[model samples]
Target: MSERYEYVPHHLLRRPVRDIATGVEGELMAVINENVSDAGREHWIELAYIRRTCGREFTTAISNVESVG
Candidate 1:
């Protein structure tokens, strides 16, 4: 399960997707906000939730996913 979730503006939730970096494919569950900083500035990172084909789940940057179909 994810720690935080947001139904991002785009219709990304509940959509099938794949992580090209890891090759894990599944449904997009949610988008979570992550705080990052560099040079005294904070940034929000959007992580997309994925339910792996093997019954596992995790969150990765939204840019890491691609439409499965």
Candidate 2:
């Protein structure tokens, strides 16, 4: 990992990545840390925000993506 990547705990914004399940490729636009509650329990999640070559955007679990660049 590069020094810049080491400092960024969970994201590589603007880097290219491919979705594991869908095989869709895109630029990683953002990393989102979210909290949610269910039945009095709290959960934390990390998301990969992406923009496809066709200009569409979406968020998926960070683990679902692999860096392509």
Candidate 3:
């Protein structure tokens, strides 16, 4: 006599769950778990946040100063 199921922790179950454009750079967070029940129906861990950073930042410094040692 055991039948009780009420638990959902897949990053609150929903929100923008489709983004896997691979051009790898930065800002990538992922957690995926897929196991379709076989008496072990406790598997749903999917949380993904990805943003490939190519935001461009280049700084070059050139100042005339005499200091050689």
TM-score, candidate number 2: 0.75
lDDT of each: 0.77, 0.76, 0.30
Best by TM-score: 2
Instruction: At residue 11, give the lDDT of candidate 1.
Output: 76
In terms of lDDT, which candidate is strongest?
1
Candidate 1: C-alpha lDDT: 0.77
Error of 2 at 40 (Å): 0.6
Deviation (Å) of 65 in candidate 3: 43
In terms of lDDT, the poorest run of 10 residues in model 3 is: 58-67
How far out, in Å, is residue 14 in model 2? 0.5
lDDT of 1 by residue, 1-69 (tens): 333334575476788898878988899878777665466765668888898778789878888889988
- Between 1 and 2, whose TM-score is larger? 2
lDDT of 2: 0.76
Cα misplacement distance, residue 62 of candidate 1 (Å): 0.5
lDDT of 2 by residue, 23-51 (tens): 89999987776665466766667777789
34-67 per-residue lDDT for model 3 (tens digits): 3334564544323333333454322111111111
Worst 10 contiguous positions by lDDT, candidate 1 = 1-10
Instruction: At residue 10, give the lDDT of candidate 1.
Output: 46
Query: Which ranges in model 1 have alpha carbons more than 4 Å from their true place?
Result: 1-7, 37-39
